[model samples]
Target: MTEIINFRAGRYKISFHILHILMTEKYENNATQVPSSDDTLLGVINYQKVPTPIYDLTRILEGSSAQQQMSDLIDLLHEREKDHVEWLNALQSSIETGTEFTKARDPHQCAFGKWYDSFKSENEDLKHILQKFDEPHKVIHSLADKLLKMAATEGKEQALKVLNQQRKSTLRLLLNLFSAAREAVSSSYKPVIVYTTLNGATPSLGFLVDSVDDALTIDESDIQSFVNDQAIKFAGELNLPRMISGLITKDDVNSLLIDPSLIDASLPEAYENEASLA
Candidate 1:
């Protein structure tokens, strides 16, 4: 039941074994720091003290450097922050004055304003910091990881279906890299290649040119004991939220390269049983 994931980038045929961790999570040598370039897909999560960049396999396969991608995403958010602030101000004024638009034009304004106000008040430094420093798309990327996990344990069938849907929704992101290649003197210098692999015995490899990436197999072991128990399910719920994996594709030969030893030894078994019903 090994699911063969194939992605075409120029001429190379990328493939790998998908392994399911029985108990512990492994992130490319247990790394907790975000990768500095497009060649590494895994990132460190920095919810506390230092941020941890969780690798999105699909994005890595697509040729985006984790650090640069994260920074660019933060920049995009900063660019839109002004508009968000304006919208927040208008909503606040409407709510205070009881303007007709308060309810009719932006009914959700109150709730949204409250959310923004909280962030603004607590993190007044956020705006100033954004002006000087930018981070990558870790938040959304993290959310995508969580959602994918949900699809893994709670709804494997449904999750795979959602990934199929994302192919179309994420086309714009993929096109951006191609456009960058066109504008750059050398595509290699442009951070267009995403090097990524799930490290395990029987490691799995995926390639994504832009966002043409799909939900490669998300194989999870050590779940049979918790299949029906609420507590086990709860445990799964807690663990899956932070489990992240994805793929990205690119044109450069070096971008898609991964170390053979990084893959786990038990991957062959994982690949055969990635699907729940299988």
Candidate 2:
């Protein structure tokens, strides 16, 4: 059996031996930069009075990672919220001017509905919160047709009153649900950096990650080393970082195992120097 610490970086769960982790702390924008073409090198930051190289693993991986995805999802929810606000405005205009309702009548056919239908996640809490949105959203959309008919028959005053009532009740519920869902995800999306050293020397490197997940114990059999796999170096693809020694499969999730010394050796020359303050 072996012990490893798992950290989330974008879509991946990456790990290193627990001993390699000197400490983990929330990331700060304190890095000092040098002129460098490598985007992976996020400059150097101060750590316990020693200059440490700060690297963004997401950049090492790609642009699409957990942190970026979380940010985008939050933006998506806000956009959906805006859509409904406009829907309500357009609805009021339709009622006042006898204009035909311009928004879709079917809840499932609307923009937010379509996105909600396609959204997938393992987060049960988020799933539950979003599911609450369905009935209220449907009710809000269903109001247009019914309220318009009421306007023509019983006069606009009563219809507008019903519309405002629904906004206060159903719309209020849906918006609260949105806020809850956003908070749930955002709470867990906090990013941190795992501070590491070369052996027990200076705190030489800091890995910026989406979040630190868990400490895991697994059989040695769960690991597969691919550092020397030439197939990965085939023409269009870049060589796998020597520091990323292997993959460890636990509970069907595959995470990369990082080799600290080799990762230090792999640093771009730009990160070689300590910050002037150090």
TM-score (all chains, Cα) for each model: 0.21, 0.81
Taking the tens digit of each residue's C-alpha lDDT, what string does model 2 give over 102-128? Answer: 798889898999999999864557888
User: What lDDT does model 1 reach?
Assistant: 0.32
lDDT of 2 at 246: 81
lDDT of each residue in 65-182, candidate 1, tens digit only: 4335435544544444443334334434433343432221231243323333443311223444332211221221222444445554766456445544543343234333323322
lDDT of each: 0.32, 0.78
What are the runs in model 2 whose C-alpha is more than 4 Å off? Answer: 64-72, 120-128, 152-155, 227-241, 273-278
Best by TM-score: 2
Q: What is the C-alpha RMSD of each candidate to the true structure, in Å?
A: 23.0, 3.8
Among these predictions, the greatest lDDT belongs to: 2
